[model samples]
Target: MGTTTLIAVAATGLMAGVFFAFSVAVMPGLADLTPEHARGAMRRINARIQNPVFLLVFLGTAVVCGIEVFQGRIAGGLLYVLGCFVLTMAVNVPMNNRLERTDDAYWPEYLRKWTLWNHVRAACCLASTVTLLLGL
Candidate 1:
């Protein structure tokens, strides 16, 4: 694989791992917590996750994937771009934003809904990674 493709693959894998972790482990653990604690923790994590490195991998994958599609070479990356980036901007981030406005009383429903979307995100990203590898 070319260097750029490798980087895109790595970034997609990272994004997939993150979503899967939340879907499989993080939310389950948080589900066991008191509503107040769970909300607070989720809020903190959502805020903290918007750092430079995460942004690099998250946005970087989209950018590279777009390049791949535009170049007509290795179009597999478009999947990651659409699934992780577009869907996130369309759905997950909006929900998270609404989640921030909510009180603990609403956390349970938010958690359930958010995690359900997260499962989609996880599947998409994981599929993106495999698709990219196949393109190689």
Candidate 2:
């Protein structure tokens, strides 16, 4: 229960909540809209989510997890970094960038794939939180 690990737990939990909300509420709400409307809304959401507060939680949590990994909180920290952070960097972000560049025709596939991967991220964040708490 060091301060760093506590921070890791809080951050990861927050991330999990965000992803979970998207999975359960946001995406579903978007899906209800027409493709053009959904695409536009998602694009705006993607842009808006890059703000400072979100970045501080997202990137800052990854940085903290990296530190935790080296400090021997390997299981939880590594899971957060690799599963959530790296996965977002590798998969979700690319899809989002593609969504921004492409037209509404891409919305169906994008919604499906993005939501699927987001579920993964949410699970990872939750698991990371639990493991980190257990490690404490």
- Which candidate number has the best TM-score? 2
Off by over 4 Å in 1: 73-75
Per-residue lDDT of model 1, residues 1-136, tens digit only: 7777788778888999999999999999999999999999999999999999999888988988887776654547777877779889998899789889988888988899989988888888888778778873
lDDT of 2 by residue, 32-136 (tens): 999999999999999999999999999999999998898888999988999999999999999999999999999999999999999999999999999999983
Question: lDDT of all the models against the reference?
Answer: 0.85, 0.96
Question: How well does candidate 1 score on lDDT at residue 19?
Answer: 96
For this target, which candidate reaches the highest lDDT against the unseen true structure? Answer: 2
Instruction: Measure candidate 1: CA RMSD.
Output: 1.5
Task: For candidate 1, give the lDDT of residue 91.
Answer: 88
- What C-alpha lDDT does candidate 2 achieve relative to the native structure? 0.96
TM-score of every candidate = 0.93, 0.98
